[model samples]
Target: MPPISPNELSDEQRPFDEHVRQVMGGLRTPFTSTDESGALIGPFPVMLRFPGLARPLLEWFTTVTSGSVLSPRVREVAILTTGSRYGAAYELYSHSRIAAKIGLPDGVVAGLTAGQRPAGLTPEESVAHDVAAHLYTGAPLPGALYRSAVACFGECGTAELVFLIAQYAAISMVLNAYDVPLPPDAE
Candidate 1:
């Protein structure tokens, strides 16, 4: 889908567009959320096309980013694993940068983006990756793995990890379904 420029937004889309721009602009994100002409990049434009659905999803996204109990590294690991599993290009592209920015080694980021378990993870990070990897297989998470995650992260943190995986998986599906491209700089 071609990007909808800010100037081209309809009345209904304008408010949501402004909300998105304001929220994204306030974040310390590692990736670009807009293009040279200021069109929303990645899934933002697609979301603007359906404000009813986008509003809640954006809320969930904000909550996930702002209110999550998991560490940034753990969250990014789960996201990269899920995004790679779905082959969601934009998802992978964006989170790969985030993963790096948060001090995840290049090799570790590369491995996650390739859907492989990278070595040198802390116990918490390993648990996060395993949880996401197991979920990617479309099977129930094994009892042992779930127990381990709980042990490492506590029940609340583990639950947050699982929810983060589910959220990113949904985001990945959206990016893939809409064929959202990486920013022009990605080329």
Candidate 2:
């Protein structure tokens, strides 16, 4: 059972004021747009219970997913790696589609789902995969791995990689502990 029932308050039932609009507005993705009539779904409705916390979480998530130093593909790779490691079912379900929408390779997603490093990753993807794997597996980053990641991603990008790992790890914990499920009709 879900740890918390999703907030079912309609937009009209809730404030739906300018602040809510702005916060929700910032959460759009290429595949998910809140401007559309029915696009506010997934963890969002669940988060409505705590607007104060949700505001910054949504804002930061938007910035990380959209404006981070990491490429969208790399970001999704790290997310998928963490989601798979934790067996966060909702994370996998949601991010798999996002990964495909962002043009991560089919084989790569498949590999991540199966907890294996998929073949045919670009050099950048490989670095992300390796970094995520090291963190998820609780292994130290070997000197060569660290140097290569720094070389590929630069210092800031490398730092963001670690941050993304930690962030997604927390996200997975929330989804798993709360038993967040795939949205209705999602396969």
Judge candidate 2 at residue 183 and give its lDDT.
58
| lDDT of each residue in 1-187, candidate 2, tens digit only | 3222225455642553345446645644333323234434545554555666666665666566555788889888888988899998777877888898889888899899777889878898889988998988788888898999999899989988988888788778867766766655456
Cα-based TM-score, every candidate? 0.95, 0.77
Q: lDDT of each structure?
A: 0.88, 0.72
lDDT of 2: 0.72
What tens digits encode model 1's per-residue C-alpha lDDT throughout 42-143? 988789899999899888878767866788999999999899999999988888888889999999999999999999788889999999999989999999
Per lDDT, the best of the predicted structures is 1
Candidate 1 pairs with clashing backbones: none
Residue 39, model 2, lDDT: 36
Q: In candidate 2, list every pair of residues with a backbone clash.
A: none
